[model samples]
Target: MKKWFSSAIVFTVLAVLVAGCAGGNTKSGTSESVDANKGEKKPVIKILQNKIEITDKVKAMVADYNAYNPDVVVEVQVVKDYLTMLKTRFASGDAPDIFTTAGYNPMASWSDKLVDLSNEPWMGSVSPLTIEGMTMNGQKMGFPLAFEGFGVVYNKDLFAQAGIDTPPTTFSELKAAAEKLKAAGIKPYKEAYQEGFPLYHILNLGFAYEQDPLATLAKLEKQEMKLADLPFLNNVFDVLDLGMKYGEGQESLGVSYDSQVSDFATGKIAMINNGVWTIDPITKVNADINIGMFALPLTDNAEETKMPISVPGYYVINKDSKHVEESKKFLSWLHENGEKYLVDSFKFFPAFTDIKATDDLGPLAKDMAAYVESGKGITWTQSAWPVGYREDTVKRIQAYIGGQGDREQTIAELQKDWDNRVNK
Candidate 1:
């Protein structure tokens, strides 16, 4: 895993040639339409992204971009099961000019299809750690959307009400803290099992706890490791067990992300195993909710605790799109003027060093940044896992947590899935 502490990737550009790259098939008329009144063609740059939570905000941002650049029309499309749908769009020859993909393996899968962005003006200002996930064979093929970290976020006032002095950093302490919160009549956790992604973060802890998490993941990719053979996994399952035992009960399977954030924001729940991304929705629900974040300790070894922090996703241009240059220009404009939206509208920790994260980015971001600064942040190992792995893995986990299978059975199923995914 790359440590993102204070390192920078400084490439002094003699001058930013705001000109377009020289190659690629430009299907001119296909991406632009003649305005009926003016008889003028206005190019359209379509963007397809996966983050449903920020669909509106992204659309709003695009509106602002369109207003600023009236010559081009930038359209945003947010989809569920983004990768699968994106593949479908590509197969149908309806691919967007710009799209989003998670870093590492997912980015690698689409590297050939992406525009090489190594020389993009924004490249100089981005953190090397942010760039690392998007680079393949020396070509930077993707632009990082933001830096993100996840673990456990807790309500500070609720903790105080429960007489808990400090955030727990170990499984035993976590269990004790949960008990205290429960005793005080606060819901210990609002586990959002309805969405497979949150449980993915939980299951990912199994890999993140390994001595060499990325190496261990690579072993699995090469069929040299099995989920059951990995140590500290029982602790990962224990954390899940603890969440279900002390959380909002089996009904948690129906708890949507919105409700989970709202519950925590309103003091209905004291803690939740989520990420800094929740800060935006949380502030909208209740701006004054005092909260803090800490690594979800996977075992009794407090020393092993670290927040999983990495570039959650990236924006890449389709190399073959007719609007490749337009897409690049749009991305450039967004990043150059996006600091305000990134901080205020998106509640993001800017991946680019030029955009500073302000003090008001919420306690979760601040605490996660501290972890990154202290070199205690770990990789989001799932980013390197097989594309579409989480949807299946989280389902099996939900089954086990729902009492549909034994732990061994679930692990076996997980291993079988990995083998089939790798081989097929």
Candidate 2:
């Protein structure tokens, strides 16, 4: 699960920090001048982020801020597997002034190292669901940067060619459609259990089985409920079973996200269960592909149910940041200006209710926007799960998909694990 970080890079960073901190104070004139300048003033804010390439819009925004604010300087560093880097920095007492956490578990674990932004001016602009995901012990520990919705992203042309009139809105219909596509010589659904995350994406659809999964999750955390007692887990097993039923072949383990996406883009697959992030790959293959989206089709009342949606990205400030005010100012600007950047660059739907959907979005994005406006969507499953349970549950799903485990055994294991963790 932590394969994102390479061991050599971690060792190199630790070595550098150790060497820098262990050096004696042999003060040269230049060093003294630098220290004096630091004391006298200009605020320096360091930001640690994953090594994702920045969009031009974000770069332009940063440039504008840098040109205007001479008193504060922002230095951005790209860290591979940012969470590992964060842990290393925390151990060394050299963490950045600001960083990003993937979800609630990491946020909760590092809550003591983050500043509570509940009173921040921009807090009111965010949604209550997002606040709940980012808050720890009733204090806001992070600010959501963007929102995303996931479902079956399908090629309209392919569906039409297959004589399918509409997207599936229920589990049975979805299975039938997959079988039809398969018989038509097109893989009905393309999944990447090899990546691990995509398997979790399928399990997340189980939230739709419950009346109010989010509320139930909260109760489970308080020991008022057990995940095993819920019927949703069984429904989730059925969903995973569907994916395995239509998977490509025996070498499914060799299938990566890129290959699955490529197959979908090339019209080899009718649909793929993914979020807005899949848009880029689709566009790259064929910008003209007519794309459409629908929820997992798990619920009986298709029109009344909403797809699972949540903030896809987050921004958090370091608890030990010396320039807290400056960091907060940057965060404010980020919340205000970041939406346009997301829309223009990544086509991400902004979580801010006041923000309007732009015409620049792809067909699928536009459809998802309408879905959200209908107020039928729920929060992302991973975001709502208790700390430590999310990843373990995902691994279980992967094991099931690989045919190494059974649904009952998987659910029983998860129930026991979650029960133990929540109790502890």
Candidate 3:
């Protein structure tokens, strides 16, 4: 793989960029629209988050917030290239009043740029995993808005038509289901590998299930172990090859995430391996589409496979924003009285304790909650990887899946890239 952004250069840029993310006295931001119902302008608190699925929902929620509380307005922006754009905004010295962070590793780069949200009133009600996931070195940096999971999101109607009674629970069953769907002349799975997000997700979850991810990462971080030493590299490569072989057309390599979601909603594909966040976009295309979720079965032992569930992002007040207090207040209001509005507005499982959305939960959320409740949920640790780790891993996986590389060589390159990143 080509040498890309090194750890030193990234940290160097982050050191300089955090200062750029500092906001000045004036609030320059993106609001939903003019508050036609209100007579006066309100103090605007801008938000920048990565979940594009909830862009409209958050806009409406903020509108509702504005309607009730006219004193302040919260503007939400959901970007595709969230990390890069956030850095761009920060470097321009026009950071949003509030921003979203993944968790410890990425947040560590900007720890100084975020306000300490340890004292947030809703923190007590938030899921411990959500809170702990965002915490770094005992500092509570942001509010985890949702407890999310990713697996095989499938079409129930399609599965039923193929005589499959339940979602696949084993890697063998998963491939069998895909074969049945393929035989039925339906594209078994949607692929969007040209985009790095899904590509990294498939491999990350595969390896996550095969090892104690935190322990493995700890050993690797200390140079006590090597990626090549991990016994699950073959299993990860197996899943990657499975997807490359049985999924949709070769052109899928160039497909975008939106196209994947849109096509799936139309019932063209039997399943997709993506995060629960894809539900919103799918429902937007066909609200009544029959959907279900199962852990991406990476093992023959159903008992061993765990759903990849964890907090994807957190809301943090920008330390340099002049409206820090107001931004916190707005975020506080989001969790006011159990965040029922948020639960209703979006289908996600709420991180807040008081909200129990049993009846209204979406299919993917229900599956994720079941795993979390049953202690079968695994952590999403890609958030803890180095900045350029995704690109490096994706390139190697892409090469192998493309038949241009072999498993042993791929494993060696991955280990070399990771070791170099850590040592540098």
Candidate 4:
């Protein structure tokens, strides 16, 4: 099934690119005619997305919008995987008029294909850092749909059983707590390194502590600072060593994402270092389970801080699109109403200030929301790494975790690769 889905996604992406190029001239003419028609006719907008399963509540909201705006028809094309489909479409220059643009690093790779939405009315509703990461050479390329934070998501019920009352505030405290939980017959931490990204995510938490890590990276590229001189990288090694010490017996390399979450939800593990979206999977296991979250602890010498987070994904308009105005209108609506739909139906936490929390939000989600409101969180490091460097770093971390090499040698190799990419 997975192979079939992957193939289908590849085929659909290729088809979209081919169709876009072949029909370019036709679309140009149609766009002019549509603009001439103005308010007299409805505009049909195409949306490319991977998430197709809209809850009934979201469907109702769309239905309501359709009733009010009979002239606009929203067509959603669902793909199986975001990155592969986007890469295929982008290479063909047959990309969708509107699609997701927020991701680690490669966001800049698509800069030429995206529209500048800096002056959009709804721009203020999203985080500026999110905009910064997606922007290339000063052009805003993506619109954030929701925000997320990664941390220690723990079961409150398990904590109570262990006689713990509050979330750990520091790394040492977390280590002590883990020991206590383990003594109570619980796995202290559960993480999956099968997909490799989780290992890099651990490093990202450490990078959040540096002052303008991304900007520093840009300077490092220009030979202003040595990559080895960065303090955050040292912090990353520190945390990984700590995690490795605690998760000694667990086969991190063998664990799949499903098994990791399942272990936590089934009460086999007391905590998991994961993002806010974990609630979705956890709820599927036991809706009554009580979950809580705390920020990843900062370095001992640094002041207490929360890791950077952003709207986990974004919506970007195609710069060369024929339906630019119409696409922008739809995006504006999405920025305003889409957030509410996502939060209410999918339990998403909106990045927008105007949106209120849904009643059904878990306690941990509420805490994350409050943390963001207080301006405590930093943007995720993966979002800012150079496009090619990001994946390379992940692969290196995965190999390191699986015991492919010693830590110093692995990091030095990665540092060299990162420097080469940045300098290039």
Candidate 5:
């Protein structure tokens, strides 16, 4: 811990002051659960995570951990809209013992309420990038869940069938490839416009492609820069335009995530804008499908193209909880003993430097890991965007795609929303 992060844990000795503190303790599941046979009570560690995809596996891991250590119990609750629900939980004095935070701006907002895990033993084994993302005021506040990569997940067989030997690495090449795919009677792209995430990824690339993404983000935060003012912001839409032209046109707005991934799996489309997390779902649909991933280029410069690799979320313990130590214990246990669940069961790529990803998570993981190892990956800029920006911006872009507004109108609305919401 000293070698990695030497900061000491500053325990919150003072009781948390809230309107309903007693109710908070009980509702957070920090209260002890009595064991009938032993006539003893076990403290509960409640975790509220956002990834609904891994809910079942997380429950299985919790069961294993509880069985291994009978004196303590751990429970996990998965939610779809995590940030809104997390804020509601804290506002109602019902915060979980441990909850997920995406770090950066969000972590800064919740820093005072998070326990200091700077001196945790496992802290030494994790990646420096993970530490950088989760740290606040020189203190490590969260345990990184795993590394995730997102871009254009494409079908290799379709590319080969189209005579495209080399996958696109630049905006020009991507358009050319799309042309080839279309000429080969293959639908080039499936824009899952029904989902906010894919569209958010496009907008995020506008910032990520900037010379200094953080400085650009600061400008946007301070209203010194607007989304339309971005040099490559139009280029972001150029990529989306390829999808709009070659994909299902306006009907792409009706393509849900499940249907998009399913279509990609069935070779109905050559590529889709998604992440490595979709591998399992796609495999479930078509195990024999050959696939690969590439960076979603935002510019004609090949040098600027890179995959977006990030720690999607991190686990932060509630400083206000009575079972803070127990929550820490559970995290430590998971880090030390949950390799099987993390790798095989959850199909996660370990974010820890010392812990190798033993099983091949998927083809997308392989491509992402290569980029990560080669320093050709970019950080997720949306993590630092305003909390509600994605949801609002996604709708704004969707409205444009749906013919409710033009591109100029979409940009104006997004900028107006940012000005209204950034400071709030």
Candidate 6:
């Protein structure tokens, strides 16, 4: 553990204290079951999540669970500004009964708040890959949802039409692909830069494509290397420029993420950036679209490209919640009955070992699956970023891409803000 991060964790304790202390442990399931059996009111289990893609599927799951069980009520709430809201709720000591948790260092920061689910009944039925992805220091903090990957999603048919036979592996090749697509009178890509999160996701992959991103971040934490001195940040700047220069005009600044997905699904653009969560919505628009994904190569060799793949998020129970036991039972139910929902409904690759993929997870996800199976897939490391890093960095990126600033200014802002957050 880095010294600065220890101080950061200590801040969270005072945060929740200044906010308020939580009430007692939640009503246990046995009592709730007894009340329901007596035709009395059932206890409610509240779940908060950030997965905007599967809102409908989760709602349906809640409905189905309520109908069959009839002993406890489950309420699902989608937080649009989930990550930001997650920290606020936690600091306020108002953490939800069960909230979605990310993997890696970010999840570890919440180790004190989360009830370890490693010894839960569902652990035996989950895939070892998932268990590994969600575990930290031998303690599993939450329920792993699925195998996930993200990169640049492209139209294979468009590539062929543009006389490009292969996805770009290096930065130069990506530039060439864009030029060919532009020459073919088709836009090379579409972006929603106005949104911080989509931009944040790009930076995550861009930074990770470096020779050793984790090591680089560790050095940054230790004040050993400057962000600009590294070769990758420069490449990231050029890649940011790549998206902006070839993007779909000024209208793209305001293009919502859904619009980006719809446009890419309809083949209006040759490429887009996103993950497998876009699969269901894209397929719903054009199930037959020859969608493909490749790791965004910011280097000279395409063969070296490795897509980041891992458990993106998990379901965590609040240890201090008034509904801990109820939350546990609710999660156990999902573990048992959610196999089909995980597949047909959510369309995510199931985290459970008992469930098998009847068909491919999706077009892009197929490549992601292969990468993970080969042990070449990278883990999404942005989950380790400090809370305000995304908001701060994205603003600088938006300014740079929008032609309002230069690389020096952007990098300066990044280093300054990072230092402020850590040193505070």
Among the numbered candidates, top TM-score falls to 5
- Give all TM-scores, in the order shown: 0.87, 0.84, 0.83, 0.83, 0.89, 0.81
User: Candidate 6 — which residues are off by over 4 angstroms?
Assistant: 1-37, 67-70, 79-95, 124-138, 210-212, 249-252
TM-score between candidate 6 and the true structure: 0.81
- lDDT per model, in order? 0.77, 0.65, 0.69, 0.64, 0.76, 0.69
Query: 1-424 in candidate 2: lDDT tens per residue?
Result: 0111111010000000000111122122111111254464455666666634443444455556656765666665555566777788778766778787755666777788889898998888765556666878889877766666777789888877777898887778888888787777777766766776676666776654466666777787887976667766677677666776787543565678899889888888878877766777788897778888887776456664457666655678887878788999988876666555544554555555454447676676677766655555665667657676777876676676667778778877777878877777
Judged by whole-model lDDT over C-alpha atoms, candidate 2 comes out at 0.65
Candidate 3 residue runs with Cα over 4 Å from true position: 1-44, 70-81, 183-186, 248-252
Q: How well is each residue in 1-424 modelled by candidate 1, as lDDT tens digits?
A: 4444436321110101111111122233257755666768788777777656655666677667767876777766666677787899899888888888777888898889999999999988887777668988899988776777778889999999999999888889999999998898888988998888888888888888787887898888887878888897777778888888998667778888888888888889888898877777787889888888889988777777877777777788999999888899987887887567775676667778888777766677777777677677677778877876877798898888788888888889888888877777
Pairs with steric clashes in candidate 1: none
Kindly give the stretch of ten consecutive residues in candidate 5 with the minimal lDDT sum: 9-18
Please estimate how well model 3 matches the true structure, expressed as its whole-model Cα lDDT: 0.69
The per-prediction tally of clashing pairs is 0, 1, 1, 6, 0, 3
Candidate 2, pairs of clashing residues = 306-376
Arrange candidates by lDDT, descending. Answer: 1, 5, 3, 6, 2, 4
Deviation in Å, model 4, residue 283 alpha carbon: 0.9
> What is candidate 4's lDDT per residue for 137-255, written digit by digit as tens?
87766776666667778888888887778887776777778788877877677667676666667777655566666677667667787656777677666566656666743377677
In model 2, the Cα lDDT at residue 381 comes to 63
> What tens digits encode model 6's per-residue C-alpha lDDT throughout 239-346?
777887899654557778888888998989998866666666788899899877877776786666667665667788888888888899888887786657766566
What candidate 1 gets wrong by more than 4 Å, as runs, is 5-29, 35-38, 52-60, 67-71
lDDT of 3 by residue, 126-222 (tens): 6656655567678789876666667778999999888889888888998898888888777887777777777777767645754467677878889
